[model samples]
Target: DQQVKQNSPSLSVQEGRISILNCDYTNSMFDYFLWYKKYPAEGPTFLISISSIKDKNEDGRFTVFLNKSAKHLSLHIVPSQPGDSAVYFCAAGEMNRDDKIIFGKGTRLHILP
Candidate 1:
């Protein structure tokens, strides 16, 4: 079974608005959660992350919220732009484990003009 899951395969948002992406995990052992953005042929780049102890973490235009009880997390982007259009992936891993990170299938986000 997949540990990390992104229910939505794609999403669309208008430019200058807010875009929200969601993810869920089945593993409670995961202590670190991260969001990555990927373009077509390029590898994924880290966007934001949150530790298990933190309920929320925010960057300039991005914010991540973790709900441990619900085994869920979400990423929010404000003032969505065309440049932000890309595939978003959610990943989770254990702090103690140095192994591979579990990644969701991905959610393609389209920023409409």
Candidate 2:
């Protein structure tokens, strides 16, 4: 069964605007959330992350918000740029439980000019 899910298979956002990618998880054991960005021919790279204890975390133009009650999380990229166009993978794991991380199918984000 899929523990994590990214409902939208693709998302298009205009450059210089805000891009929001959403994710949901059915496993309550997940206490850590992470966002990864992958390009055409490369492995996914760590973007941002958050813990269950925090509602939001921000780094540069990227931010991640986690809602434990809803088992939902989102990644927000402000002032979306052309370089931001990539497939974003949402991951969740239990920090204290194990090192296994469940990843979603990923959502392709296109930054349109």
Candidate 3:
């Protein structure tokens, strides 16, 4: 069973528009969730995170919302820019498991100029 999945492998949006990416998880035991942005040939950088106890977290242009009931989460970026084009990964971890994180394949975001 896939513990985490990003159904859309890629997306394209024009600059200055809203870009939304989605993720789903099957493991309810995952208590910590994070979004990471990655560039070509580079490792992912932590974007935002939400503990199971919380529903939403935001940092600047990035926002993440978690729906525990649906075991789903999403990332939204407003005024998307060309620089925002990159791969985004949704990761889940169990705090009790010592923060061992599991990642979705990734969503490649292409911001059209």
Against the true structure, whose lDDT is highest?
1
Query: Which candidate leads in TM-score?
Result: 1
Query: Which 10 consecutive residues of model 1 have the lowest summed lDDT?
Result: 93-102
* Candidates 1 and 2 compared by lDDT, better number: 1
- Write candidate 3's Cα lDDT for 6-106 as tens digits: 99999999999999999999998999999999999998898999999989888898989999999999999997999999999999999877646889999
The parts of candidate 3 lying over 4 Å away from their true place are: none
Clashing pairs in 3: none
TM-score of each: 0.98, 0.97, 0.96
lDDT of each: 0.97, 0.96, 0.94
Candidate 1 error regions (>4 Å): none
Give the TM-score ranking, best first.
Answer: 1, 2, 3
Using TM-score as the yardstick, the better of models 1 and 2 is: 1
Q: Provide the RMSD of all predictions against the true structure, rounded to 1 decimal.
A: 0.6, 0.7, 0.9
How well does candidate 1 score on lDDT at residue 75? 97
User: Which model is ahead, 2 or 3, in terms of lDDT?
Assistant: 2
lDDT of 2 by residue, 11-100 (tens): 999999999999999998789999999999999999999999999999999999998999999999998999999999999998887568
Task: Report the C-alpha displacement of residue 111, candidate 3, in angstroms.
Answer: 0.3
Model 1 global lDDT (CA atoms, 0 to 1): 0.97
Separate clash counts for every candidate: 0, 0, 0
